[model samples]
Target: MDESLLSIMEVREDLMVSPIGDSEPALRSAYFLKPIAKSLDGPVSKVLSSSMTMSLPPVFEPKDWPLVIHFDWRRHTKKKWVEWVDALQLRYKSVWKKVGIFEAIMSIKCSIAKDQNLCFGIAEKWCAETNTLLFPWGEATITLEDVMVLGGYPVVGDPVFAPLQSHEMREAEKKLILAREQLWRRTKAKASLSAWMDAFVNSGSEVEHEAFLATWLSMIGFSSKGLVSTLVFPIAVHLARGNPIALGPAVLASIYKDLTLLKNSIVGMTKQLVLGDKLELEVTLQSPFYLVQIWVWERFKNLQPQPRLINHEDPMMFRWHKVKALKIDNVRLALESAMEHFCWRPYVQYAGKFKVFYPENETLVLIDTDLDKEPTGLLVSFATCLRVSLLVGIQSTIKKYLPHRVAMQFGMDQDVPSCLPRFDGTKDFAWKNYCRPISDRSLYFPARLFEGDITTRYAKWWKRSLMGHQDFAKNMGHQDFAKNIVRRKRSPRSPQVSKANKNGNVDDDSNARKRNSDVDAPSGFLLKRLKTVSSGNSAQDGTIANESIDAYVPTCKNLSNPSSSASTAEYENVKRISPLTKLLAKDTVEPLMGRLEEDFEDANGSKESRLSSERVSLSGTQGESYTF
Candidate 1:
């Protein structure tokens, strides 16, 4: 906690931008880098340097996993389950919207593609101490903004543990308990997820909808072992009644926890390598790590695959559906040189157009029957950058959401982040403390939020920090920050001195060219190289995993097609039969009002066709649609 980097005396005020008299900036940058630098030695460094030529240890796949291997419920998604989901979309569309999980459910229905090989490599480089990837260029990590925009979780909402007391909620909880008990009796060991789902899902019971949400939380939101954990009952019941939950923070917490676990596993693996001991390695990651791979693909140009271009109305992850990528044998070398190619603000391009997906207001009235007029997904993006809040995850898991730590992800200037006092309240009181108003507004100007701006102070501090770890810098070839990097600046000299220097055989001109090319190479070159490799034939390099992105594929069809109106009409017909239609007759659920205004084209290039809404097949087809 650097006193110079913050104004701790002023309560409820912006800390980073507020000036304090004569205090030095926080020196924690080196503190953050030390652990990362230490981890990059011995076997880890040896493996990365030679991964391109030799077969290295399979860091991505461990020998044994504690929890269920599947990250999604796609395998359990039968025809009956798809039909129930359709009814759910129609029945409680407002419930889903209030909870900020509409796009998440849509992405889940599309069944996110997975690439098992990408996680361990990326996770090995993660620094849990600072929640960033310690690259030679600077710090970068997945922020709450990534969770909001890419994972479709809302940044502003009621806490996950907000108390609920209603007849319907009570009944839902009871049903969940009964289902778990029934499964326990059948197994005589532990509760079975499959048995519980088969018993309650789409059974025409009043609580079936709640059961569906619980299944999602178990499989997607809060992953667990084979058992149907009772942790999701409260959340599911709250969501079924059209209440808001700050799911974005909770989901981000899970990712961070899993990343720390993976990092620790690598440390353990390296220790075994040094001790001359052969042990079966086991890695356990129980979150939607697909999003982690997606984050890497989105920012690092060299790692990206060719992705399909879909309408903005679609979830951003859909762009990478079933996409392919070039197999990079040397990940560390690519990451070391990825400084210029990284997109600091990838979501900036969709700034004005994608506001429809987020909420505009900080406060939401969840119980109101008229859900049509709720604020769109605009302001939450800005709020996520300014707020200091706590995120509560499954089974009482808690983590802090410190946006200031990675402010650059939100297009703000980088600085030493301020620290807050730990919440000392009781468990019941602490769970409800998440949705308070943001105290900092010094850097909230919307116009400049996506400009990819930086400050000289940041660059100088970053350079000094990298230099502190001289060994890591020199080994990774960070020539720009090397001790010998600075040379005598060329200034106008007398003709006699210039000729005298030239006569001594000094090649200053070539030296200048070499330094300029390495240090100030144009960004477009790497970007173009990324695109070329993305479009190459798949036969050139075998697909690493079933999941990865191709960031440059064209959209399936034109957005201005004449059949757009018919698509909207068809979508409206499905909404007309919603169970909530009569319940909230005053304000009908509007037809795909936001991004769906432009009809999304099927993969076959058809102008006026849509997938059947009846059932979703788990055939693992390239263009399966469960949009209904």
Candidate 2:
């Protein structure tokens, strides 16, 4: 079939996908591309069926779309349209271009294309090339690697983020949630690492423990080789005020401290990974200066292929458990530490637990140790600093947001460590991870989101897994909606009266229950009478019978009258007798209920009348105290 027959709806149906698990290795398959719009008069029909329309998105220029875009009522030929698409394909080679903002603008393009008929061509190309499917209502099941490959990028292992602004940096702290839990156990709620590090070998969190030992060992590897680096920085408590994160307690290790404890912790963790748990661990000695290893004790098979450019000439593959700087364009040096460095920075070397913005390979290169440059007020502009599974996924994102040739040159060349940290990160991981050409299918990174999509996914998974756990509902933060969900954490609200009475509390509840007992009293008789009045269709009518009041007494005399109770009971019973005839005919139930409330004094005068009746009824006589 020709492109003319492929309508937007047909394109959607073609791209419909079935979910494959993350553990499943990806493979390419043939897609049946056929024409869809059978009822169309033309390819760019203004109206297709009743809902879908022929119009281009705002991102597309008028000269690019074949349809008569109503923006200016300008139309173009199919020949011109093809040329425009060609220009776009050439200009923006990758779709990873600026994927996230406050509202993920990159993903929104897919949504717009799915909704509009004219954008079927672009949608088709994305789905086919990326090996992704576009579902109905603007959702596409895509992994970070798929977007990376579609945009002609590489997949780098161990993703981290550099947040420049305070908000974005704060958002980046989500990665610490799991680590915090480990740190808490290590610190024993004291937030004192001095105590914690003494028993580091006993720390239970396998992930953080492995990551900690691996990071320190990597540093040790570099330090032993006589190379000094300024990459690692400890994210301090005071630095993150207001929302102080639980990054455990700060362990400001010094050069003067005994190195024996540090050595024991690393050896213990490594032995645990290899011998104790019978786990096989792999580490690549990129150089004496760099060591590529797990941030924790991770399952080797569950991880994506850990390819490395061991020779940068003939690549090699390694494995592990997986989990920045600033610079200007000119002279290369480490960016000034954004957070404080309370730990020993002995000739720019670090030890113990610290946080970094990105994860680089173990073979780190430190050159021009004396060079320095000024930062040009360019801040890292990202709504979120996500720890992506594949950092390289952002590679082919069409927008190469570097400053210029000077910045790109300093950052791109792997040998130069003098440029800004963030600029270098954008290029280094992609360049280093080029182990081999992946042609079969797009390689995926287990890019877990600490802040966005992945978090929601984990929450949903928990909701399912802990289905019957009684307190799960209360912990989910949807307390108001708990009634609608599968199970509620709280018990029903019926046994309160008995519990209250047992406590010897003669509070307002007892009084209210006694006064309201009259409504419950007559309901036994009223419902039986209601059966005779109704046609048996009003299932909801029974609810009002429970609330049926005795009478609407407006004056004090009516309340004092002996026949008032009988009269009020008769009045309300009579109303129920014509429930269907009177209530349904005029549709005046709400108004009648309002009238009943307005003329009522039960709620308003009952307390006062009760207090008066309970007060001493003197009857023109004093108490039996008799003037003693």
Candidate 3:
């Protein structure tokens, strides 16, 4: 409610969280509660055990994971889309900026390597009750920060479903409809994706450009397969007219929705397995899940494959292009012991160097409507990272984002997050009110990368918040690790605390100057900028329509062969292992088995379990290519 209590949503020491989905309303909860200390250690926290270990549920097992049906159309069709995007970027890079999709479009240029094993492993840890991953170390989730930087979606913009108003926008929609109708007439079927591309790829009209964006959103952004859908026409029209839509939050919501689905399906399979029933259900992921794996790679350093290259000039996603993930014998065990290996603030390390997103004075503002200021710039992008708001996913799917829950991601202290109110999926809830200012100015806080600790009561409350009762703590296999924390009077990593002077400004000028110097520094090697090509016509706007698709092919480096030495070394020095290690060791599924035989010692005699290593291919039906 006030400036000093900006990042916390405090609660009473005796307060308790309600059961995850109780029918009763949450009692007397407020967005702003009693503030907690932001220090790394608080009030001599006690630990009951010397070592911590976790008990992974049945869902963590690869043997229990449901078969995934991914959209893989890229392998079947000629990649004309690549040529179209390259040509489009050259002519309309400015237009892309106006529409808030410059970064999103640029990101698709590179192909990210797929690792479904890693994706399935992380999805298993998702806690739908709190929208955070419950790991042995603490709670962490893919935040809006990850979405903005990795996925290149705009954080602040008009709602995705904002109604079209201008006559030009309506005319553009009519043009798209007519074009699709013509294609349908000739094909004697629904609009063919290939036929649609031929009709609009280089038509030179602005409407055709809008059609290109619509197809891009359907195929690349939102994952629609085969026949084209008309759902994205309105959104495309808005973009063509230079209006920025909030695709960042929308894409994030869709990712969250798909993760929840995957998590729920895994739980369902676990239940089926427990009851001795044959599992036949398959899970279909329709969102851009490569972003999910990239999120994992960015934070979990131990699990990341060595990157092929680092180019600061390109979108952040380019770093992982064609890089293969390390093959871990036990994903669950590796994740459990990865607390110290996790980079709590990865973006902070590259913030000064990344051309895509660097902090600035203007970026500190919550929201600014100045048209001259680029929407995708660090200004709006940075502000979007710190605010708590609702995300609008693809058509009808909606999710709430509570950044305050993992305030450490934004360089702030952890506290009890405001209770996210449950919403009915069947109704359109508060659709008209989404355009309101997303942040409260009174609760502004500066971003810092140094990790902060949970409030004294927050640490105690988190243990019980899982199932909404004290009994849930007894069920966890891991012990309390509060004693690992130590109080420090001053840390070089932490920003100096400053007082608000009489003029309502920070008194610490040294920290401000240091931040400015960092912002001015170059990151790594910059890529060579592409030279402009002129189309020689005002209508074409210098788009390279005649350029050959083969002239600019992007090639991927070969994946490194899986090696046991590196994978084994990470866990070789471990002193303790969880009980699940034995169960995983006995799994005879060759593909699921990692090279951990050298490290794991199963004292009990090994028992054989029949688990299938053959993954079902959905490409025959789905017909879409996978993109990271």
Candidate of highest lDDT: 3
Q: Please write out the lDDT profile of model 3 over residues 419-511, one tens digit for every residue.
A: 544655431343432333322221222233233434545655555443243232443334454433332221123222222234544334454
In the range 367-389, model 2's lDDT, one tens digit per residue, is 11111210110001000011111
Task: Give the TM-scores of the predictions, in the order they appear.
Answer: 0.63, 0.15, 0.65
Q: What digit string (tens of lDDT, one per residue) describes model 1 on residues 1-628?
A: 2222221011111112101111222211010100011233344333222212222233323323221224443344545545656767877777787677877776665544565546656765676655566666556787787887787877666666666688867777988888778778887967655766777766787778788888777766475664567778888888887777778777888888888777776666666665766765665566777788889887775677755545545677666665665577656566767655566656634433343222111011111222232244333344443445566776667766555555555434444443345555654454544543222211112221122222234445455555656655653446342222223321211000000023333223334334323222121111110001111111122222342222111112111122334332222211111111111111222111000110112122222222322332322234422221
Off-target runs (Cα >4 Å) in candidate 1 are: 1-83, 188-190, 356-374, 418-433, 440-443, 448-450, 474-628
Question: What C-alpha lDDT do the candidate models reach, one value each?
Answer: 0.48, 0.19, 0.51
Instruction: List runs of model 2 lying over 4 Å from the truth.
Output: 1-234, 238-240, 243-628
Weakest 10 consecutive residues, lDDT, candidate 1?
491-500
lDDT of 3 at 563: 26
lDDT, candidate 1, residue 167?
80
For this target, which candidate reaches the highest TM-score against the unseen true structure?
A: 3
Clashing residue pairs, candidate 3? Answer: 72-624, 72-625, 73-623, 73-624, 73-625, 74-625, 329-594
List, in order, the clash count of every candidate structure: 12, 16, 7
